[model samples]
Target: MMSTSFLHPCLRRMLSDRGGNFGIMTAIMAPVLLGAAGLAIDYSNMALSQRQLQESTDSAALAAATALASGKVADEAAAKTLAKDFVVGQMTNYAGTASASAIRNATNVDITTSTSSTSKSYSVTVATSYRLGLTPFMNLLGHSTIDISTTSSTTSGTSQTRSALSMELVLDQSGSMGYDTNTCAQYKKNGTTCKTYVVKIDALKQASASLFDALDKADPQHTLVRTGVISYSNGLLRDWTNKVTSVSAMDWGTTKSRDYVTTLSPDGGTDATEPMQLADDTIKKNANSTDAESVAHQKKGNSKVDRFIILMTDGEMTGNSNTWNKDKDQSVRDKCDAAKTDGITLFTVAFMAPDKGKSLLQYCASPGGNYYEAETMEKLVADFESIAQTATKAATLLTN
Candidate 1:
């Protein structure tokens, strides 16, 4: 690496060097390669921002639809306000390329209703378009900003058919979660400090908090949504068990799970079996009693209640060597199978993990959007929010 990297300096160095054509090429292409890499990073950031926008839109659409179905939104104007407000709130909570004011201004919401003899339906659409600023590399290329837009639609059927949900977040709080995801030196400050880097645990906490908030917007009364969190490193930290529910159906709402995640101090080796089993049991017990989760929804005439488990990990199962443990890995898979057999939906995330961990998460996932492999902290946050958005759409997703 050259200390002075201007083109003139590189040419001068290349000419005087006995390293010859190869060194000259290396010196010349070095800047171009670095510039190209920077541009790629900018494009990747743009992609993540757009994806976050889409997810926020999706959540907005669902929240508006739920409000309409629950009679909280009286008319089309109210629906629009609800949708815009929800999305703006989410964007405020989770920073994106587009500012909250910009996102709110660019967003559009449309609602249409249909009524049959015994049923009512409301179709809601949410869309947003904004200009995202790019990095200096893109500016040098004469592209300073990119226009991005996203749209999502949801339909709310009769209240009697809309289902409720009981969700559990099984998080891995192994020592690795305390590590940082900032790889490129260009994005760092002069001094290396705790405040300068993005830790994986902090990223999870933020993403999980956003997920809870979006769900709250969908079910403000907490009657239709109940979420819980349980983390395991070497095993479940006994001291933190009382803070969040491990084997309860109606324990988490907007703040309970967030509180637990916010205080997570990741340490020790990774052992995820115990918590995953507890989570599976806590939410799956609904099958015996028609789902205690569906009780409030049932009072509102709902008959279905879906169960979800969001399992996230940064490493494969651990053994004495602290690397891979096949038997324990299978045990986790067995728990996944048991939960899925009980009709529980699983959303698995492998964040900054090795191939073995990714493979394990892929196996635990329920196919399609259920599996997320986040190589960056930004993607991890987006993936968790996506999970929350997708879950709420179950009762309202329309194909026709």
Candidate 2:
């Protein structure tokens, strides 16, 4: 009944009115949108500042811990002041003087220091709090400020044993030495290959002796060094035995100890796992006991002594032709893990291992434990020395 035309003024007016409403709505919301962007920028800046402060505080705490490890400070006040000063000084210089205001306003830093169970070590904790900058947009969103915090800790200890060392030198006497491989061609100075008389096993033995000599020379105190040897091929050539000849039953001092050697005659199958297990056992048993050396070193307040195992193998884990892979000898790994749980350090040395075997040897060490691969007698000798030094450093830091 009501007539309608294709173009109508009423319809056009309705469309125009909607567009006006949209414009009004956008005007009302524009500030809110801009404020949100500002808020995002503020939050990002706060996060970055928090991260920087945390890093600075962490470094400070570590430095303080090292200083405390010297055993020079006796009281808590001294320790705290030392830690705070170290942390503040480091952080202030971290970014130069120009950023001093930025650092101060961005974070609140604190450091706490405490002595170890033994009076020789110190533990430090660093904490930092960052106050968040409010974004203009965030104000409309109801957040005035945001706060972030982070904390970190570290420990340092001094060396109490003057000539402390735990060593296990393994010599390989496998038949591989009978036939000179292309690899052995280089060690020969003259036309004759060293393999002709001194086989691979003999070279290894010499290297082991050299390592002992180094240890003897490095010993500062005559009564402090302890040494062991494990030789393996088919079965364990040697058992878990301590120093063949201990110089003196003294503690905390090195003694002129006789060098010991355990040589394996190449003849049987190869089971590398057994030797490692046995060496680990020997170190654990000796460290726990009050031997002449331990008795001499006992003090009023000191942490429990630690043991170490240095295992070496020339080939992959193979013997009896039944198993060459390490997965089959998980029992050995379990034992090593148990020793580590008991606080024994484990190191592994591999000779002439392929890629796969090398990784296996490295894994034999506990996390962050020592793992070295040596192809020649010289490298093997060097590996032993390095392992000895690392163990000494760790022991000093832990016992001091």
Q: Which candidate number would show the highest lDDT if scored against the true structure?
A: 1
Candidate 2 residue-wise lDDT, 1-400, digit = tens: 8778756988897777755777898899888777879777886877676676677777766766666676566655566666555545555654456645554454333434443332355567766554555866777777777776677777776645443555554444555544333345344666565543445566555556655566566555434456656555664554358433211121232222122343245655566566666655555545465643244334422234446666666665566563465663465567667767755777877777666557666777867748888776678767777876676565553353
- Root-mean-square deviation of Cα positions for candidate 2 versus the true structure, in angstroms: 17.9
Which window of ten consecutive residues has the lowest lDDT sum in model 2?
245-254
Any idea what lDDT model 2 has? Answer: 0.58
TM-score for predicted model 1 compared with the true structure: 0.56
The number of residue pairs in model 2 that clash at the backbone is 13
For all candidates in order, the CA lDDT equals: 0.79, 0.58
Tens-place lDDT digits, model 1, residues 271-389 = 77888888877777454566555555566554577889999998988942576888888988898998898789999999989998989889999977699989887788789888888
**Over 4 Å off, model 1:** 1-160, 183-195, 239-249, 285-291, 294-301, 319-321, 397-400
